[model samples]
Target chain A: MWEAADTPNVTKEQLQGAMDQRFSREIRQRLAEARVGIAGLGGLGSHIAVMLARTGVGTLHLVDFDVVDLTNLNRQQYFLPQLGQEKTHALCQLLRQINPYLTLLPQTVRVTEENAGELFREDPILCEAFDQPEQKAMLVSTVLEQCPNTTVISGSGMAGYGSANDIHSRKAARRLYLCGDETTDLAPFRGLMAPRVSVCAGHQANLAVRLILGEETP
Target chain B: MTVTVNGQTQEGCANVLEQLTQMGFDPKRVAVEKNGEIVPRAQYETTPLKEGDKLEVVRFVGGG
Candidate 1:
């Protein structure tokens, strides 16, 4: 368990140096300059953002309109004190704590077809982490049809406490990659759990990193 | 005609839209890709599923 008192005060240069020791100079440079857009700050989005930040993704555009609620605590990357706070704002705070030098763009608004293109126009890769089926389909369709240059990484069917191994990533289309079991659906008996959600989120985040590194296939 | 959908081969000649409906999928809640190219939702009705065409129809569900 980490406490504020135990937090080590480190300079940005020192942190960058530490990261440089792990990843090749070229890889770290690419990650430090990559601008990625993530829509939705729910279970998958929040985790994906944090992972990207930890991996040294320099610029991230986090979009979400919902607020942290009691129900979101089970699988979301938020604490009890963050209840009622907008997801975008709360996630930005957490991400800043991870990498202060990262460029964070937190947008607290519902992403629709009209605004998604404009919001993610500059990003080469867009992660679709919306919860509802309609929203997911809408965003994927919007990006694929309108934003031809942006590759979409989407999550689907990561519900229920099923086998974590069942959740895997795949190249769904030419420019679209999907992460999840691609079959499991939510239900009263098979509710969304933390382990499986994180497993799927890991796939999405890892896939994003791979794509950033020019590894197209999932 | 035998067509593969999501890795499962099925015997049908239905177009993308008709095949999705027959599979009990909500047309508005899924994205379809045929033969390595994305079949836009607007073109689903006109996108013909030829024999041996590979189709990847991904349906979004309620989760994060």
Candidate 2:
């Protein structure tokens, strides 16, 4: 159960007012009407979802089949109590605490090449945050080939304790934008950490915000 | 012929598949864009590379 402070008491209008104070009302309204999709609920996806939700993106389609485990606590945004629960459920609970009015469509299903196209057809902008290389390639190719209407923001090569400055966001194609250093491969000696993963997540989330607000460049 | 791959100009092969193989990329695991248009995986073998054509092949690396 959420503690008293964990529960949000502010009304939707109050939340709108607070966001408007930070940015212009026009920007806030634009964000409130935009829809974004996330393919994984791991380090990059979880952080990206929270960032987008806090930025007031109206609707999110979150898809992931894995359950939260003890190892996820280091980078993923989940509490110990959420362990053994589906990632979609754990993330939705956290996002609701941030923005109760936001529309969250969470699905507990694995994204495969066969279902990826249909799964994300409704999304205008989809974030590819899968862990394995083949899964990342599958989603990017599926969206670019099958779902021509959706633009993909993908992350790669954010691992280990390397300098955050190496990470970058670049437009690989008209509809695909790639983020991260693009060279750091996960190895036996190199493992993922929070700071680097969050840095890459920031790139993906910021690019998503930019795309929503009609600033698609970069 | 010479073609640009990922903003770096380099020697090109007869087709996208050949060039990708020469450049050490698994054609099955990367997305290719030639002259601003996405080349579907099926076309990689038949898509011919032209001189001065711009190709951006994005390969996924392991990590989050």
Candidate 3:
């Protein structure tokens, strides 16, 4: 239990008031208690993770095995100093800096069929950010089969020449939103650009917030 | 013969390849589902069209 301060102290009302200055107290409360799991810390994942953290999501489960490469600077949040650092670690550090109160669980390991279940057990809302088509397919299939109750929003086909209109929401199944291009051949090897990936991440974050607030997306 | 492309009816000829070409589809990059069954990319050219065939073609692009 927190003690009452002798001097004038910040009350829950004051905290709530401060939150209300920017967002409704109810919305802030919901954001403060939500837990989001982001898989992959690449271009798309970095943006999604940062937005969710800044939005006041209380807990974040960040997973990625790769390090920041020079190429990632074009879009990823990692700075030159953070290059060679594990993406999950770098993103987690950034998230903590953005909101010191945030609880970020960083997993510096690749998500695979063998570990996806265990990693997602702590959080029911998951975001899939893998760039490889085959890996994305594997992650989505495994999550659907193993964590049927959890809501999963995945990114796909965010490459090549396309507009924001290409970013779409498809109901792959009950409680599953497939965000991004649903095309199969848009693998990263086929040339994924920065702006397109960011666009997909924006959609993912928006969809995730809607789901968290108990709203239905078409 | 008749086939459906993206919910639009198209004229299907004896040559499926020529029909696809006429339908403004690039056989190289699109995945074709014929009557709910996925047709392999290799079979796009040789497979013959049939009357009342329903086909779904999905084109892929890259990002993230």
Candidate 4:
């Protein structure tokens, strides 16, 4: 008995076999359609990028101008071999390896007020992983004023002597999520820790997924 | 005498700092704008309240 579902290109038996083997069809479909733009390739950015990539984000626009240094080994996921490599480039390579289907666009340039608009014009959502307060503020303010329709999620104060519970999400304004500490504490500048950065990155990735899924988040 | 803080009308009191504290705001975390000008944190304690004053208190939140 010949069945149409057993076509050579996409056999129903093969498709059913794959479906029965791993992730559900719905999850695979979502991963193929999702496009995420990550701004910053530091500790938080690196973690977020990898998580999103593994989860099936179809395309990733990674923007970062800095190069990897010895200090970054403590928190960033890059290897010592990747030293001197641009953060965006290294991250793109790593993410692509995780999921070969992922389309990675690495922008090896700093995200400045002059270029942020053009950089984000194509991406519907923006994930801010900047470590400097001034830079974060500039990005957030610009996005709010210029690209009103696009959603911006900015990370802040994921450092110092704080429990994972201290990290939180606050809705500072419409389509803007302020994640991490709500204080001007500078302890993280002196010494960057892994737990805080990882927790914050997790929160940022979680929020991004929630937003894309049309789920309510505070 | 009424002053609005976050859209709520509160009775104008003698000391603005006391009123803000009573309203459940930490003095250090908030910035006060009186009559369109930001009142410095130093002035929160001495600043007096007036009738029908519209005060916008901006709080600092962390992110970078």
Output the number of the DockQ-best candidate: 2
Q: Which ten residues in a row have the lowest lDDT in candidate 1 chain A?
A: A1-10
TM-score of chain A for each candidate?
Answer: 0.94, 0.97, 0.87, 0.86
Q: How well is candidate 3 docked (DockQ)?
A: 0.20
Collision pairs in model 3? A158-B62, A158-B63, A159-B62, A159-B63, A186-B61
Give the candidates in order of lDDT, highest first.
2, 1, 3, 4
lDDT of 4 by residue, A165-195 (tens): 8888866555567678766455546555777
- Clashing residue pairs, backbone N/CA/C < 3 A, model 4: A155-B64, A156-B63, A156-B64, A182-B62
Model 1, position A170: C-alpha lDDT score: 90
For model 2, state the Cα shift of residue A197 in Å.
0.2
Backbone clashes for every candidate come to 0, 0, 5, 4
TM-score of chain A of 2: 0.97
**For each candidate, what TM-score against the reference?**
0.90, 0.95, 0.72, 0.72
lDDT of 1 at A201: 87
Model 4 DockQ (Cα-based) = 0.15
Q: Write the per-residue lDDT of candidate 2 for residues A1-218, one digit (tens) a residue.
A: 47658675899999999988889999999999999999999999999999999999999999999999998899999999988999999999999988999999999999988898899999999999999888898889878888979999999999998999999999889999999999998899787899999999999999999999999788
Model 2 vs. true fold: TM: 0.95
The residue-level lDDT of candidate 2 at A110 comes to 93
Alpha-carbon shift of residue A47 in model 4 (angstroms): 0.7
- TM-score of predicted chain B versus true chain B for each candidate: 0.90, 0.91, 0.79, 0.83
